[model samples]
Target chain A: MSDAAGDPRVMLRCERLSVRRGRREVVHDVSAELRAGEIIALLGPNGAGKSTLLDALAGALPAAQGRIERRGRVAVALQSPDLARRTVLANVVLALAWWGVPRGNRAPRAREALRAIGAEHLAARPAATLSGGERRRVHLARAIAVRPDILLLDEPFAGLDAEVRASLLEDALSALRSATRATLVVVHDRAEAWALADRLLILIDGRLVATGPPRELLEQPPSLEVAHFLGFDGRLDDGLEVVLTRPAHVALDPAGPVHGRVTRAIPLEDGVRLELELEHGRLYTVAPLPAPGPGDDVRVRLEGGVRFPRFEASAPVPSTAP
Target chain B: MRLIWDELGKALPMIFHGNPQLLDVIWFTVQVAVVATAAATLIGLPIGLALALGRFRGRNLLRALANASLALPPVLVGVFLFILFSPAAPLGFLHLIWTRRVVFIAQTILALPFVVALSAAAIQALAPGLLAQARLLGAGRLQVSMLALREARIGVIAALIAALGTSLAEVAAVALLGGNIYGYDQTLASATLYEVGGGYYADAVAIGIVLIVLILILMCGLGVLQQQGNGIRMRFRSAA
Candidate 1:
């Protein structure tokens, strides 16, 4: 494992790491390994310790218990990048200066990083005056300028528009793919993680519930919690179990098992999302149909169905035996 | 009102005059203020940054000590320093009494607490996200301090200006330790006090006007610098 191609080393490896904010232990015992040339996306809902885990990996918060083994430098782009009262180019140059880059060669390197992010034109502008998306790009460029062995990004694409988001995602992916370094990203949205991640880790209440390739986790989740988090509804029919994946995975058919009338059809950029009113309230399905108006009778078929054990409800039933 | 207007008229020319005596007093005041402000800043900025950034035991006590020092009377500070550096005191052998250096030292001590308190407040008032982001950028301790200072440059300048102004207008500390010796330790404030004691009310008021003008210019310069720091533009008309 240590001598593999494109693998510098295990950049950061945690063993039962825990972190506490104030008196509350936000991160429970968590352990994971981030390898080189891999873009790992941490997925969770709000208040699920995703940011806390990212902070631990970035070394901003110390682990209260357990050990974190890091082999090389870690550069982080925080959720809110601190823009100094200086020009954007100066911000990048300051990062280079912190890394001990000589004064003579710093400008070219800073300009190169800015160009990589398509922010070279805004170099002379004051950073405080730029848009939020532009500031995020400048911060990303500053982080990438260091060329750290591990890069941690916390919600780097949160406030960016779709185009800028795609561009930044592509730049990050290219950087992660080309370098012999590891990248860890924290995102609450499943669609984004599926789009950009090589491997995915789902964190729930400070615990690592599942970790695997993006497709594997999306197809057959470890549990109903994982399935629901991936925007799916898992049900049980006697001994047989079934999992309903995302709306985009279901297709329309003339004759199918699930039949319902389209209650609402929302047109998306790529496809049309139709809300089908089946026996279980409404089920959402996505298709590349040309604007299906509401109140249309539609039949849906699950392309790749998954089966799992029945879900166990935590609450108890009231006794009515007489 | 008439006296103020007459004094102002006299003071403007006196300040612009090519006399060495007047120039010397102005130069002495500026030198003392600059030295005091620099020394205070050098000692206070790090201590302030450390108090704001570092998490340790007795941190509140250290902060309280700094805050308490802000209320110290200049005369008391002069007396304490005078005692410490007088000819019979333990450090008296250095012979630092009755000199401009003593006045500078006294003023620096007098201004230290305000600088520390204000700088620390500025750092503490910065957004917490800023510090966290700085750490994430691989900034160690020194870089973190520099980043905080850069981010709070406006407030830091404000604190510096206040310290400089206070040091310039101070009399007891300089008068007590400096002996008000002409051409040696006499500042504008001390010169005004000396002229008033000698029944030269017109000269005293004239010196007072110069001091007021100097303070006004200093304050306006600070305001402009702060606006530039905050990226605010000044309004003006063009010849076109």
Candidate 2:
């Protein structure tokens, strides 16, 4: 992995922490460190204990085992933007007021936070009246307004228009670039993590499968489990499955060794994106001009010299789920 | 209909004259309702919020008991409190027997279930993240409770209206516990009952009219509170 974290001022560190929900443990012996000025994306499948870990780190959930040390104030933008039953400005102001910011200093600072996220126009609107994207921005504004030393964002981009998601991603990236805080985000896919994260942590069944910079992890995933998670569905010449590290890895070649029937062909600025239905499932490939149209037989191939990396846990962990 | 009209014709003059006894009964009714509601709020809101948010072995059973208590007979609660407050009973030290205080206890007991049940439901309907957000923002336990209550103001207001309605209109509890003594424990509801039992039709009708009017006024005030308290709920509905 690309160094558990590049620069280590370990703002928040969890050493062998296990979190329990009722009698069952969701995160078991998960240890990691989030350093200052680093953006780490946590990726996992459903019920993979990602949220359990986040909640434990936020100190909202109890850690049944081990210890977590948090050096600074934490700002959590929860999955659901639960604004108070108040005006938008009041929602942001309440967060500041609760954190001991002087009453007189709250509104202006809240407005500044909203202004920072370009959501100042929403300050007067009732928080309940906002749409999904507006709620996300208002929540982000509230969290960013605190200027917290640690930011824990759980699915902050879950429900938003594509363009809005892109813009929010850009804003988050820019904010991270300019700020000196540690951020841990939970996102859906590797592409999203690749865009906004300095490092990616892959968790599966309450165990850490891999950790590293997003691109490096994808290029040389530490485990076959993580390789499949990175969407490898393609087979190499030696008959082993591997992921196409980037869209640039795909190309249409008449002499290409790999073959599949084109199911869909859509045009883009660079080239046409072809969806090929393989034996196992669907495979998405990008083709330049002389691109195969729908119903055309195509020979597609991943760039040569892709190696499968293996990541093994210290001790075998028996996975469980409901 | 003719009986109502005849009663109104005879009672209108007494109402217009602003009979002191009738005014006293009305004032007593308001006092009992307000006191009972306030007491119930003090007793039930915390219990309700606790039941809704707490995780313990018997929490579900306690919540079920609170909800089922809403279906309890007011007269039965009155009887239970009556025995408890009786001179021979264990709780006889306070000597609240046959007084407004005894009636106050009964009314509060009657209202407690509605307050607890509705408050719990309201707190439960809250977006699950509210408490977490508050805590993460450096709010202490008390702050979390206060903020959660404020966020649940709309539901709590509805709970108050319901409890007040029951406390205001209930006669059996007050009649059994307060003994309906004139110029003392006699509330509008009990006074109306006493006038009817004594065949004083005009006085009963007059008290009934005052009761209805008072209910209308209280309902109007509750309506205003509901509208103001539910601004956030209304916005959410509109947005949806």
Candidate 3:
């Protein structure tokens, strides 16, 4: 709903965009503006119209209603490779060719594009034979080959290993940052979205529920639905309500407001996540040092927290007494 | 069995010795099939691409019509062409009846539907994701169609071979429309029929043997092309 000039040149503008399939509206009155030099991550649950919105933006499907204004060319890299049964280089070359890049110069340009995505080594392999991660890289290279003003990626990291996913994300983000283009990435992982997105748009049931900076969305989480979406559970205790985000967001302390014994400890790459059962059978996921083993008495606390409204309290609380 | 062996013996010598008559029939079959295939390709590629890529109304009807035409018996197609090119038909003024050209035209029509239907299916079989990718790469309608065709090249080649095979083995259409004039319309199929009618069963059998050999060779050649096309496509994709 912000004006185009307030942000980067509105590369793509969707106003009240709606798409229907078989009499059911899959995308309902969704409006978003993709500005140049910005990366917007469309986050949602499965079948939440994330892919449908990308499809509509890419002009793959007709909008049931509303208008989409695109200032310049927009490129899309689908989750699938979709490359011809051609060599990796040829795939990029073909995309370049499609963009009317002359024949003589396309080879080097294609090579450059492939190199940008670190797929140059795979330039000779059959695209079909490349692993899912490799194919996605090639697809991304081909999309970038056109130097599109707007790029739409649908779950580009779905099947990639962590290293490959990180590399690809870095490559895509770096490229978009340098170019005068806007990118819209659809991802289900909050951590990945947080890393790559400058802005986040959450869609629930085909409706855009929240749009803001990633941290803002994560911190406040517009509503209970959004909080639940952020992987949080709300609990009521002693006429007070507590909302616990993911275990990764919670930290433990001996003198903290909430105290509990560590029930489970799962070691992560950077830190160990502890699953603690607070008094009254309330469970919380938090990062705590010297993590108490299962059955070890430990105190816990909420840090960088907010008041969480209790929506329901029908069940009796289980005693946390040992 | 003796008759069959005798016919085989005679046909082998003629084919090995490069007999002009036998060679002529072989040459004629290849020429007609190739020309017909080419014409069909010209017409069918565009039609198939259009049918598969177009967003217009009645696309399904057009597809159905093309598919239905694939089942059109060669004889019926030949008869239809014969009527059109005959002295009494509406297109009879051109006097094209009983000529190799007439046979070529009839065979092309016979092959056209096969090419269009099969090519359309090949193009249609390309993953929707591929088209979406191409469009996102700044490919317009024609570029997307070309990309789809390229992606389905192996399928297209297979379709081409199927169409060619249908035309090569076709007899009724050439016989009815070609008039089987010696050295002109007298293809292997028509010659075999002629020799059989004249009671020269050995020569008829020889032509049959030659026809079978030619068809086998064509099949082998198509197989090789397909393999090579596949190899090239694989290499190219991997390099990407």
Candidate 4:
């Protein structure tokens, strides 16, 4: 990925963009850039301004403050797309027709788009009769059919079972890989962002807190808040530093520094999830089946952790790490 | 009871035998109703669409006014237009009173509010964000409006049927405006009133039956249109 400084490939640029809903500002003044041929995943918790930000970027909502510049046509598949009461093929064809595609070429292009997403078999079905998963695929096909320079998808994997999500994810990735357009997808799961995005952006409470390559940001989250969002389920606070660690990074040992009493042992398909209470806070970890039960004390060693200076939990976090 | 049965027997033959006066009344009624309903639809749809989709000050006020007019009395409209087209009134120079054109104008006025209010309600019932989504997909302003109308077509068709029903069955306004001039402005509705007043029970029954049949035919056509537009259908199965 190219840096934001004077990159000619940048298809979208936002400088200090802030958006307001009614009386409250939901998206703070944040600057970001999307370059050509990169998939950027925007990760945030529920109501972290993810959808609102996408709407502002898509020009569905007006910017309360800041500047947005787009170099080419943009297409967005909203989280809950409204499908007209028509056949699936006609739905896609109408979109192309409204975009001024020639009458002779619309059906062929629509069919091709549906074929790319493995939805060609559903061409004759009424859009209203489609299943939830099928509706998502059709929405994606409509966006992909436009062949836009900038594409925005808001929670494409939302509300799907594990098996269907996996299948759809593969199809979505394959379709996205075929194009070199700049794409931004909003997601809540860290694993999904890592799998699909070349770079990840972390947003919390309407502020963009961190952004970098997925691997780089995964190893070092830069702050406690960002670490928690990245699935660091265990936290150990020494007198000098506050360390955040994922369940996979901590191991059981006799002489480990951190000691905790097991509060609950929840069984999982492959293992057990041990909920432990430490002196300062709670920690959770996965262990093999037949592991420690409730009321048992255990000691664990931290493999390495993202460390931060000691500060009160209530202290305001900066928008970005120093 | 015997007299009623005798009139009904005569009415059936009068309808089946193609009575010339009855045929003329039916044709005239259809012509005036079709013209009035078509004119009302062409004018009211855009106004209703604007009320549904446009955001501006005083829009609710206009909508409230339209809703209030849904119950406007046809006789009052007749009286109002009668004064306007009277020779001594301000619009008297047009000399439109006692003519089919006057009947058409009054019926259009009577039906306009129904079309506007019902069509607006239909468009407003669509799912939120449909318009914005279409715009994001590269639809221009006019295209987005057209899409909205198409999405709410079933409701619009119902609105049109309501307007046609109102125009076709109109009597008080047609009487007051057209003066029931034979071969000029006489309609089935006004002619029925004339026949009944003159003690011509069989002719009145025949005209009333034809009017009802005309309404049924038009409504059935529109109902079929509504059915074809529906993409979702409900099915009921017993657990036998």
Index of the highest-TM-score prediction = 4
lDDT of 2 at A285: 72
Ranking according to lDDT, highest score first = 4, 2, 3, 1
lDDT for each of the candidates? 0.77, 0.80, 0.78, 0.84
| Candidate 3: regions farther than 4 A off | A1-8, A234-242, A249-281, A286-299, A311-322, B16-19, B233-240
TM-score of 1: 0.82
User: Candidate 2 falls in which docking quality class?
Assistant: acceptable
- Residue pairs in steric clash, candidate 1? none
Top DockQ prediction, candidate number: 3
Candidate 3 lDDT score at position A265 = 76
Model 1 captures what fraction of native contacts? 0.51
- Candidate 4, what DockQ? 0.41
Each model's TM-score? Answer: 0.82, 0.88, 0.87, 0.91
Clashing pairs in 4: none
Residue B136 miss distance in model 4 (angstroms):
0.6
Model 2 chain A weakest lDDT span, ten residues long: A313-322
The DockQ-based order of candidates, best leading, equals 3, 2, 4, 1
DockQ of 3: 0.56
The weakest ten consecutive residues by lDDT in model 4 chain A span A313-322
Candidates sorted by TM-score, descending order?
Answer: 4, 2, 3, 1
